[model samples]
Target: MHPGIIFFLVILGSVLFHIFTPWYWTDIASNWGGMDDTITLTFWIGGGVFIAVCLFMIYCVLKFSYKKDRKVEYKPEDKKLEKILTWATTIGVAALLAPGLIIWNQYVSVPKNALEIDVMAWQWGWQYRLPGEDGKLGTTQVININDDNPFGINLDDPYGQDDVLIQSDLINLETNQPVKILLRSVDVLHNWYVPQFRAKMDAVPGIVTYYWFEPNKIGEYEVLCAEYCGIGHYAMRGGVEVQSSIDYKKWLSEQETFKELIAKQQKIEFGNKKIVKNNNFLLNKEIYKEE
Candidate 1:
């Protein structure tokens, strides 16, 4: 069989395999935000160029292979040809990079009115903090973990008084919910990943990191901790249920009730219960702080 034909067949098979596979990430998300579209464009263009180059090389090798006693023809390297290839490569790279940088900039620059939520990761579970009605989530630490306080918020600071805290509850917010996620790690690094949202970010210990996304679709999506942490790495998973705004509020009310039950079950003091409840609630500057 001709090498050229074999090469083409091999590439064709690989492409077909890639097409038939139902892996989640490769398939487009339910929501194609600006960043998602930019990625698609960049990948298609770059991949086309890469495959063309490979196939061209393969064809050349097969066409120009040596034969017994075959006379070899020599052609001097053309400066003009070299210059053209150099410029082509340079321009191609720039074309590929420009959109990526633009989308990245948009991702980092959070909208002025995005609702902020703080996410904390530990050995085997995930915790969340939402600004109380006041719309401010105060800074937190880990030493406060107890029956009364799961997220050690510095209550003396007054800045943390109304922040709402949650551990392992599915929050269902209304459609087009604008959420800004603040990620932190208590012990080891972890990654918060949601395939349907096309969003993922690392939860590094000792440093706070985050990402934001709007859940435009209404459905339940699986959340996975992408970073390998320990023995329970595979089991470190969660779920996000996107719902209408009204439905989300209803869910929030239920969570509040559930939290109260949890406190009673642990025989936690009312004062300490207030502290933990405030850790996940929202608080605006006017009610909590001036800044």
Candidate 2:
């Protein structure tokens, strides 16, 4: 009797705690409500199974308690009981997995008209690339990466020259615009996650993975790396700001293009060499005069 009461109390406490818990899903700002639905379905199935099992245990404790006058019956196996248990277990497992499988099927299907944005991840930072007015992104290679070309932009590629290079961690998006995010990693593996968007994908090396979502809300959201890449993994954070089309265009215009970035780097390098040559000439004239 006492054990049955404890099980009842545990079930009651669990339900109450869940109902009043402070932490729950964040407000979704994208078009992935199916993801949330799948999660809610999982919770319901799991909670139902937990309550049913506990109730059975409570019944057994109260009705089958040991007594001095009671005699035990030894029936080792019952085919009927075994079949019922097997079917119940199979149905419960299937219920938990089917919703997830359905949602995952739609998660990878990118739309035809979705805009393109490239996200590059490193140990502790994020970089982005967006297509210019040409509506196309330039190809990149790992071998082309250097101090002057951090994004590994191929200088010879005509399409890459006009690509907008965003070095900042905070990226801007247009609300109601369907955009596909292309993920890449310069170093170790990382996962880009934005809770509000309900979308994230692994940034794998030497390959690209992608997912798409249309931002329906106009606001700023926190971006987090869901994978542990290294010691600085905790600090691998970024942000996204969804705005109106006019504001997004203004922000995009303010960003530098790959062509402009290359020109600036070249000017700096040339200026440094010119300064060194002038200093050498001055030193030579001074020695010649002294002689």
Scored by CA lDDT, what does every candidate get? Answer: 0.73, 0.93
lDDT of 2 by residue, 88-194 (tens): 99998999888888888888888888899999999899999999989999999999988788789888989899999999789999999999999999999999999
lDDT, candidate 1, 1-291, per-residue tens = 877778787778767766686753544333337766777777677767867876997879787788897788787788999999999999888988888788777666777788887787888778777776666766666776564556667546455666666777344545686778888888898998888777778999887887777778788877789999999999888778888888887776554422353457667567788887786465543557656
Count residue pairs with overlapping backbones in model 1: 21
Candidate with best lDDT: 2
Q: What's the residue-level lDDT of 233 in candidate 1?
A: 92
At residue 181, what lDDT does model 1 achieve?
81
